[model samples]
Target chain A: MYSPACKVTDIASLIPQRSPIMMVDDYIIEDELNCRSELAVGADNMFLDETGRLSVEGVLEHIAQTAAAHIGYLHRQAGETVTLGYIGDIKRCAVTGPLPAVGTTLHTHVTVISQVGDVSLVSAETSAENNPILNCRMKVAEG
Target chain B: MEKDELVKKMIEILADEFEVEPEVIQPEANIKETMHLDSLSLVDMVGLVNEEFGVEIKTPDLPTIKTFADLYDYVFTRM
Candidate 1:
């Protein structure tokens, strides 16, 4: 039961974060070590800076949740329960461009660089319509 | 790549990242203590390996790797 694509509802079932806070919308399962997710920026986005744009932290959380979804997908494929995971550390984080405008669709990509015991190091990047926005490497772990 | 070549290349990569002299890195060297690699640098090291070797190193497996020789052996087997 490998679903190549997932909707928002499917994302809810896979991850612990709920709406208003959950940044990921749709995801494409590239493989066990990689995944791509979509986030539709809107005024309703929870973490918007004063300019009515997604805050930098929001973008980072989107990247983190994308990694979490990848882990959840792996567990699902293995017939195990999806557990809560936190972003333990973030390294080499860089925001290259301005925050995407409302109604824009951000494409996020994450790769699992390393996984030791409870901690997994992941590299992630977000772009809107081929324009790079931000990228970073994060350490994720189960709670 | 031969073992010696692999070791040389790894040293070069690490030296460039850690801003240390390549000659200072030896296969028997303990990267953390010798190179003063903090936890963040260790994460960056994993990134470097993934970029150069295209192999994803697991954190759980990092414990088994301490010295440059250990890293070389693990990476060599994967390569």
Candidate 2:
């Protein structure tokens, strides 16, 4: 069992997302290059599809937020305030399995592949109940 | 690696990655112009070259590598 370094209650302070849009609920950092996050899909989730499952866009946002959380954690450790970030680009995104339904929890892992200047390239994989759901590479830039 | 082999490999790799024709990647042509590289794509190019050639391109050294020939020489000496 991997215990989260930051709980859902404290997530908002780390990442710059507010209500309805916030996708991550828990976060754990394995190292400077790797981190994991969790998102519990609820009935009121804004990105739910017509079939009652989380949408692909929702999963992508969750992965981006996971990367944001990693950068935010580093900023906090340096006594700096959290800065806003944007997803500059996404490549090689694929839905590998069924999307998670409401009441399911999404587990996401992020690896920082490289960082050049303010842009960080990261690879992300998300799974639900041990079933792989999505994988992609994203360029996240601090704004 | 020999300079000729390095140039051939670089052209093939860069052309494929940048979605350009190998014919357009001339030795004296400006790399950024030929590849249509923005900052993000330039980073991608750097990462790609690093992966392929095991040459770590420092940020400060980027401006000196303006053409395919420069990039070839850079990697050749480093490798």
Candidate 3:
């Protein structure tokens, strides 16, 4: 069984990313096909632009990392190494609101739309509170 | 799936995703070279296989695949 709440320190082992660059704080696998993750946006986040707002690319990465975390959690459960995964492509990405500010909690939800041979196409959306922030379809590849 | 049927299905997927005629893809045709597959299209191919066949292809293994026949054999063995 997997815990719903994960410690921030354990995020690193689930994903290949490290601090400052790692956007997700913790995550939960809701089921076999869906996962949810959250990040406490801070001034130290590397994706902040000159305006101190998270860039569009940052939002995409946030969603991608959440998906990665889900995959990682499964790998760990199977007693396998968490393999490296890459964002093969991003499509239909729409930023609907102002970039979230520091101190805001970003909640990301990812659903596996399809998966074939180490490649998965996922639909992801991010929100702050009930307000929608971004949505997109992403292709993830395992390496 | 039979070998011939599998090859046909893979070819159809490749043709549809790449926007090429199915007749263009031969068993020995180099997919990347003949289809002019860009990096993004290559990723789409991976996603297609995963969704259609329940396979999980890794990027490192891509280098080993040069022809449609090679891809077919790979997926066939795994299945």
Candidate 3 local distance difference test against the native: 0.83
DockQ of 2: 0.40
Proportion of native contacts kept per candidate: 0.31, 0.14, 0.28
For each candidate, what is the lDDT?
0.84, 0.89, 0.83
C-alpha lDDT of residue B9 in model 3: 87
The DockQ-based CAPRI class assigned to model 1 is acceptable
| Native-referenced TM-scores of chain A, all candidate models | 0.93, 0.93, 0.92
Comparing 1 with 3 on TM-score, the higher-scoring candidate is 1
Clashing pairs in 2: none
TM-score, second chain, candidate 2: 0.97
Name the lDDT value of residue A70 in candidate 1: 86
Indicate the residue-level lDDT of B7 in model 1: 84
Off by over 4 Å in 3: A1-9, B1-79
| Model 2 DockQ class | acceptable
Candidate with more favorable, higher lDDT: 2 or 3? 2
Q: Output the number of the DockQ-best candidate.
A: 2
